[model samples]
Target: MSHTIIVGIDGSDNAQCALKWAISHAQKTDSQIRLISAYTVPGVNMSQADIVYPADFDAAVKKTIEDTAEAAAASVTEAGVPVSTTIVPGDASGVMVEHSKTADLAVVGARGRGGFAGRLLGSVALAMPAHSHCPTVVIPSTWPTRVMPDAPLPIDLPVRASGARTAEADGRDRPDFSGEIVAAVDPFETDTPVLRAAAAQAAIYGTPLRLVGVTATHILAPEWMPSEDHLVKMYDEAAKSFDAAVESLRADFPDLEVRYSIFDAPATEVLVSATYTADLAVIGSRGRGGFVSTILGSTSQGVLSHAVCPVRVVRVTRRQPGRRR
Candidate 1:
């Protein structure tokens, strides 16, 4: 089976940006590109309408799909890469998710037709990476370079072996974790899964993991003034949770080095700011709130749109019923 890099295209500017990034990466890795476009038939009832058009709607849609595919393929071909195209009729996110199960990587634009305003995460993009069996990369519109012609795309390999604590030349001790891992934890939510994933990735990368948790609160207080003690206590509470989460992962990764930070600003801002220094940022879909809640909280959505690095959204699939910590 050919390892493929799948991209969701809707002919939008953002989609094109994603397509360019995917094309470049695919070229570097010698991987085939599957440029996919999804279209939906407008709901119409022939009985209600008095006039009927001579041309068939399905045929028009088919032509549009083919045109989009050709355009995408042409771009990749210009870059000297081999690419194929597919057009499907259905939900865009659903189709991409199905294809991602077997693909090496699924790439999507930060903003799309279905994404929310104020940098809130796109429903489809957020959902796909959260549940995807493979690694997913959400490329933001403002990435420093739109197309990488000569830069070699970084590839992450799963962890292979375990080692002891050793100090590097930089005076920092080497971590037991093996993979490149970063964690984005919401302070309001219990961060068990985020911690677990980070530890696992660190083990795989054999690199240290950075754990970042954000707490957004109003700047003002009810009392005469917000005292230093109050601020310290708030941060202390957040720190306690951060430490607890890291501790739980310690048994599995004895040499894992975890760095935790608590930010008292908007969750999205804090997380995105940290992404400037990270390879991958891990975040939970919904926390505290049940499944009925939205896929991303306001902070997460903001970060999704403008993060400096790639984002990995972890969706909660199976949880112990009635279990609360």
Candidate 2:
């Protein structure tokens, strides 16, 4: 089945990167790409001086939005993917969330034009995964190398904020692009949207699916210390659950290669580490540990901020009983 993928654009290098990623995914999945750019009226303070507005102010704004969307759509057309453009007037995040209700996937950059050097994620990037009705993919600023190695880097490289250092200056290691799709699955939880998405991505890219789970370790409190036997039981149950999940996934995708490992550490840390070598990392919007109704779980938040690879947040919510296009 063909899918409808939404690409949010804002004329930022990061958003351009997102467009590239979305086009590539669309080519692979035989999906259509919808390019959306949101615009808001300029909020200028007119208390000091009386400023006369131009007669064609609204027309100028609409023209600008149309041009921006068209420019982004050019890339999608060149990639031979069916594309549509929508210029909406609203907050970028709100626009994306509203459209995501019918989109198969939503893609955006980790940072946008207004992102501060110290900020790892842009406001839209943070909000989409939490409130999107479909899976939301956040492409990192450093993703060009993985998707298009020969392509030139964006000209407008962001300058570091005061007291900030570059990744190379801090001795950061680059990702290896191991060509495997990784999923941070909750073994004890029966939710399979994350797993199914990861498997489908793996198939699309012709890569192996790596299922990584983390077992909770004992917590130390002033008055309570968990017994060794209790910890052992928990670990054993987690192992069994992991095995069952792996078996089920293997059965579902018979010809696909599926592997799994359980780590005895925090979920966010382990998953973040796994992203260094993964082609893409798929995860659920929320997990079992935090608030039951959290729009975005703490673990997913941490990984999205720091993961070296593109992270897809799969949110399982009640549907309206039919698909949109």
Candidate 3:
């Protein structure tokens, strides 16, 4: 796939942060930036019942968005990445989702100036991952504040890639540190694709793939595990799944340094803890057990909200009758 990354801008601080994050990523991957600034004609806009619509109101709104896109393009150009900007005439979320269908990745700020002004997570950030055609990354407001000119590429990987960083925060935090990439899984029927996504990411970064399978031991097993012996057998089965998954990735990328971990704790807790040391946390949008949900599963949401590193929530697109993975 071409390295095309789409990011949203709204003249908000968080949106600017997302744009800069995208620039940094493009620099690392030698990708192109498609900076999009979406504008909407407000319901109570000047054309309301009591007010006269200013002749220049529409032009002004378009100009403002155009300027935002131009400035974003300038920044990317200065950073040595080729960029393309667009002043989309529509709602932000819908415009982004539409572009996501043809892009390799889509990124959004945790929150922007919209519906709920003071909320930490915004409507667009929450909406994209669940509906995007590719992986969507939501950059938090509290990002690693390293100077852009001084930032280094993620690591020594042959594949072009971009990911999150655990900020010690360039002196803002007393101790800055680097971290790994964690691929979270449930080892259940639904998450095999999640595992593949994580493995692909690990391959891209040349990072050690950490396959963390989390489960709560006290939770009652299904009817098939009616006895303690059956429970033991289930545990053994899970261990085998863990190893097999790792082996599968190793088979694909012989040099990949993979690790297997099983924790008898909540899936959210394990993945969040992993994020502290992970540059990126990869998870499926749906799974069984704690991750059982339609789209944007509870477990995935927990990690997205709490992870110290950037999280990539990939939608496991089920194969259609005549489609490919």
Candidate 4:
């Protein structure tokens, strides 16, 4: 089977941004794009036998989506990328999740056609990534607002490198490959799948991979510790260990620049800020704090709720990757 990247489109600005992102990314990866549009008919009364389904209405909806998909396909082809189209009648999240089983990656917008302002995680965006069989990337609505820096990054103990961006002379969409790829490290034993996915993303966009190790009390918070200083010391030790881990793994991908740092802050907050200078931020569905019944952990929710750039949530095993300390 040919490699495929599925993109959920609803004609919203966020969906358009997602389409653009998927197109540019597919072009870089040489993967074919499968654009899908799903819809549901409201106010269907089963008791009314005389009432008929509106064929014209259905036809009109199909026409609109087909046109949108066509336009997207033309744009992708113009960019020298391959594209395909599909239309389904059902819940948008359900359809996307089903297709994700066979897809290389699934892309969606932060919000869809319906939702209130300030809502970062729409029903579709939240549901797809949680239920997807593969990795899912959700493009934030505020992505277009990103511009070249007018100020310096926040100075902190943990090292940071601002992925440079040179604004275009004419004001148009710039491909997202310009910034670095930020990946959250679990410290003890990183999730190989998530790290591999992040590395592949960095390699595809020709960007650097910044490994951020965050140690918080949420998971490793030992109540038995005498004071906060001890916890910080433990967190720092975990962070420094990643230095050797990356050293061994970076050799596997010589083309990618892998750098790592440790910080004593909330994992979600640090990752959300990283999105500002990162083309894409990747995290696992469950962190050290995740529960068995939880579909998404608290850290994933915090970052996905308020990120500027695109965020990806890769599925992890039900249990934590490494043994607890």
Model 2, residue 312: C-alpha shift (Å): 0.4
User: TM-scores of the models, in the given order?
Assistant: 0.59, 0.80, 0.78, 0.81
Ranking by lDDT: 2, 4, 3, 1
Give candidate 3's error at residue 266 in angstroms: 2.2
Give lDDT tens digits, candidate 2, residues 174-269: 223266788877656533777788887887888988777665452346587667787677766766776676677665577887766655556676
lDDT of 1 by residue, 50-136 (tens): 656546887797787788779888998899777888788888777888888777778887777632111345656676765665556
- State the lDDT of candidate 3 residue by residue for 195-270, as single tens digits: 7777767766767776666555646556543466765666566667776766666556788776655555567766
Q: lDDT of each structure?
A: 0.61, 0.72, 0.67, 0.70
Q: Considering TM-score, where higher is better, how would the candidates rank from best to worst? A: 4, 2, 3, 1
Collision count of model 3: 0
Task: TM-score for candidate 4, please give it.
Answer: 0.81
C-alpha lDDT of candidate 1 relative to the true structure: 0.61
lDDT for 269 in candidate 3 is: 65
Off by over 4 Å in 3: 45-49, 115-119, 145-178, 188-191, 221-233, 317-325
